[model samples]
Target: MDPLAALRRPDDPACDVYLTGTVFLDIIFTGLDAAPVRGTESWARGMGSSPGGVANMAAALARLGLRTSLAAAFGDDMYGDYCRDSLERGEGIDLSMSHTVPGWHSPVTVSMAYEGERTMVSHGHVAPPRDPALEGDRECPPRARACVASLVPGEPQEWVATAAGRGSLVFAGVGWDDSGRWDLAALPELGHCEAFLPNAAEAMRYTRTECPLRAARALAERVPLAVVTLGADGAYVADGRTGETARVPAIAVEALDTTGAGDVFTAGFLTGTLAGWPLEDRLAFAGLTAALSVQEFGGSLSAPGWPEVGAWYEGVRQYTLSPEAAAAAGQDPEALRRYAFLDALLPRCGRPGPLRRAVPTIGFRRA
Candidate 1:
């Protein structure tokens, strides 16, 4: 069932979220004990491939039951075909605004996961420019309730402002500034954004604040909402409009791979915001989704759906109900209460069956 079904309107935007960016074919290797030596060949215990980059967030949103539309460039190669099929057929993402270029190879990233951390090596060529005519009758993006923008340090995308002007709430996140110029002024698009989500390191560097919470406060001055993700500690959010602030601790889980966890966090936050969840609930939900993502391998495929969320909620509820189980796990019962809001949100029929997951390889024939 669609989580936002109650919020649906006859005149609502065509999609719940719209995203545009490069989609990379991610080949991931897991279960490594250590980094490979320069001259040594290390065999990984597990491997998987899936669409990554912006596809990570798109997949996450779709899995969370959001109607997602993606605008991206794909190559004519097999990697591109697999990615297109996975997103469109498997994940149910709208790709009408996407395009394929002749002879343009798809971007590829090789990720090695070990000890909850990952090392990535990438190769790709610049994608072809998007054709405005392909978007629709206008030279604008498809109307959406919200859009996620990847803010590059020096380059500001005009579509962000256009989307906002067209009644779409723009949520922006930034990549690392390799130029060493952590000037916030470089991200002019923040003026047109409803929210800005950055990791702790990026937030501190951009705001020149020593603390992530202080950095989020400083950023709230520029954007309506500022969110700073503190990897292990959790996430902090400040609302400039209401001066409401909240911080949620991260869920403790055995992390298999941390790839695309930040993107998953952003998607989770977007879901809660669109659903009109409370501040603390939103942070907790986002943190929970991110926590679930890290327990699996790969990026796009690792994102959790409603069933996974439901399962986790049930497990936690059961744990809290049994004093023995609580003590055995060494988990605080009070910490589990933070997610009691899920009781009202989850389907009463019970958890759904397992959904499709990321596989070790692409291009396998389905029987």
Candidate 2:
């Protein structure tokens, strides 16, 4: 069956996992300093916008070959309308049960800060139900296989859950992207899902533990699996099954924009897992998707499709190794260096290098 056809099927093999999350219109500016332009230096580049947040994640998941759907809320503004149109017409993402509010502008994101390390300033779009923020009418799907519970600063996560209940696998992001503020109420409940994806810092914030290991452990106590993205350190995977822990290295790449890399990682990881790909391949797929995400601007305007991600991984010789594999292959020069580690491990640099390895459970610590 066409993966997306699942959107029409509410029963078994529901179209590529259903993603119910937030959808926002994103505005990105380039060549501008995050710092204020004080005196004579007027500016560098202007501004451009794209659909982001849960919208970006949904789009990323769609690129990875999922028959995707978004249950989100958007303002009834022109930009919100454009955002919904793109989700349906341009990307073919399903958008049923989305709410739309009038008067307020759809959510917008401004990408500021420096290269590698950047930040965004955003305004909320979650108004009362009166605002028309969703892709109305025929966009709603009968069901979805998975959902993305994204808690924007003021947005409530309860509403982001897939209406499919136990049938829908839930994935959530614990962050605000800009100020790092978020909803703690969703964390404990988030533990009930099949998996959880939160960046390293967000993980730290979630569990109130600066140590990623402790954070993962604390989170796992509530859920079965938690994928903690450690920026440059790679990612730590804590599995409730088999009681194993593993660290997967990031693909090496020179990154221009770090925007949307984590969301890209989650997209690839979920796509792979739903396809029944194993943990090892899933991690590599996550990294590969992130590498492709940075190559473009507007968050994910130029994300790589599934085949492209896999090809890129093999081209870079990006493959996970057993502890024995690492021991037998010896080492390369770049693998030994500190700054080189940053390229693969640092959030600023994009891809992460190998920090450690394991047999089955790749505990998401360090990386």
Candidate 3:
């Protein structure tokens, strides 16, 4: 009857899933601008830190009420310390597989967004071809009802391969541009993944695809299930079983940072799958989960918990915008809310005015 007994399979009482990937300290900055005022610095705003990438995804999945086992690596430093402690203290994550790399500085990222869009500038002191290993009492995979891989760069894909090899159902979605450009080499990585969900940009950037559906197809060839996130345009899922792709409509809601919406979607899908929901229901749940995410800043914080998501799903109009409001705002009202949230949570370029000056704060910074 012990929860740990169900760590690998659904019937097991504790039914927990394990997440293995690279964990980093996300030092996110909201408003970043270095517009040259002929030697005078412009007014700047500051935003602090939050978890990112696989770590953020793990925390999100845990918040969905699953007892998750995390197998991730971070450099032995303050960043690493913070990452480890924070995840360990989460409601449902198990830290048996998390580890620390000696002496290396943990990874960090900074983002500055305007309007409804954003530009991410990152820093990676960690190099490529990394095989992150988890030690101690982590000898076995948590008997999970499902498994997910973040496939972020520096995280060896084989770790997920090992998870798949162990009779676990696998879901994969690459993280950031750091996972490297998609190519024939990435094909091998995709072979073992079950659900390959990447945004249209990531699909086009890594996997060769001229269109969103084509991206889904290319991903389908490697993995049976594929979903391509299309912002407000909604998403398309490859349905090999139905002989065509399924268009999952976007759930209407206010958006903020879209930063980790894809990760939030993946969590929703995995959670739904484990709960025995049908594929259509799974996508809708995921769609709404992501739709609500952009209404706030950061990843896990942006992702609404099940109760909040349920409220939005139940026609909670508090966050939904109106057509008249969208027209009045000259942009989607939700998008406007999202921009304001970004302004408060991230740094900004400057206030808007008739006599204008807008400088992108992110592209100038180095990753």
**Candidate No. with top TM-score:** 1
- Which residue runs does candidate 2 get wrong by more than 4 Å? 1-14, 39-42, 45-48, 99-102, 130-142, 151-164, 176-186, 208-210, 317-367
142, model 2: CA deviation in Å?
A: 5.3
Clashes of each: 0, 44, 19
Over 1-367, each residue of candidate 2 has an lDDT whose tens digit, in order, gives 1223323433465455566555666666556655655575536464445677777787787665677766677777777777886677667676755666657677777665355676778877455553344334532434456766654554444543433354666666666446554445645446447788888878788678889977877777777778898887778788777566767766556665666788888887786566665576566667767877776666645466644543443433422324444345553323322112213222222213221111111122465
lDDT by residue for model 3 (260-279), tens:
77788888778766665556
lDDT value for candidate 1? 0.90
Give me the runs in candidate 1 sitting further than 4 Å from their true place.
133-139, 348-353
Candidate structures ordered by lDDT, highest first? 1, 3, 2
Candidate 3 stretches with Cα past 4 Å from truth are: 1-15, 31-48, 101-104, 127-137, 140-143, 151-156, 175-185, 204-209, 242-244, 314-367
Task: Give the winner by lDDT.
Answer: 1
Ranking by TM-score: 1, 2, 3
Higher lDDT: candidate 1 or 2? Answer: 1
Q: How much does each candidate deviate from the true structure in C-alpha RMSD?
A: 1.6, 10.9, 10.1
